[model samples]
Target: MANSRVFLAGLCLVLSAAILVYPSRAVTAAPNSAQPKLVDKDAQESIDKGLKYLANTQRPDGQWYPSGSYGTYPTVMTSLAGLALMAGGSTPESGPYAKNVRRAMHYILRVAEAEKDGLIAGA
Candidate 1:
């Protein structure tokens, strides 16, 4: 439960950070905006690298396997990775990572379908 809380907190942080990176398309701000810029080049670069790592590490099954002790947490990893990608401004419908996000969702749905219970614990 503590781990889940931590993970959820981290997810919230990522989602909030994304607001600073990408402004809302639906609601445009005024000319005298307080926060005009997204993220700095360095921060953006770091985000890019992190996103690239996730993209590269994603398996064909749309799951992510962490090294070492956390190897068994593929379901959680995939869920988090998908959320992270969404936080980075990519949706399952469209974005730079649209394909990756879509694939991840597909895998998730597949797992859910196979499980008699709705709990998605693994691939």
Candidate 2:
């Protein structure tokens, strides 16, 4: 309740500020202003490369093998790797790394199914 109240108060303040600035008028884009590109070609290529790397490195069981300091945390690595792939637009049902995503989900589900409380954690 307290959190909601604070959020509402902040939202009201922001809305009031916007009203004061615009005064019920519709805003328009400036003429001749070029539309900003969301991502540059170089940045997009880097993202693609990174996504491919993640997909390639992911094990067939949906787990990522960690090394050195992270070696013991295969669960964490798998979850994070899955999330990164999702962020890069892959889902278990579709997208470039769909098989990997599906395998990851199955791996997590298999672990959770074996646990008493359905928690996905280290064995």
lDDT scores for all predictions? Answer: 0.73, 0.68
- Write candidate 1's Cα lDDT for 34-110 as tens digits: 77677889999999899989998999988887787745777778878987888888876667887887777766666
Model 1 regions more than 4 Å off: 1-38
Q: Mind giving the per-residue lDDT tens digits that candidate 2 earns over 6-94?
A: 45534443354344334543565554648886689999999999989988998877788887773477777777787777677766666
lDDT of 1: 0.73
Q: Local error of candidate 1 at 22, Å? A: 9.9
Evaluate residue 100 in candidate 2 and report its C-alpha lDDT on the 0 to 100 scale.
84
Instruction: Count steric clashes of candidate 1.
Output: 0
- Name the best candidate (by lDDT): 1
Top TM-score: which candidate number?
A: 1
Worst 10 residues of 1 by lDDT: 1-10
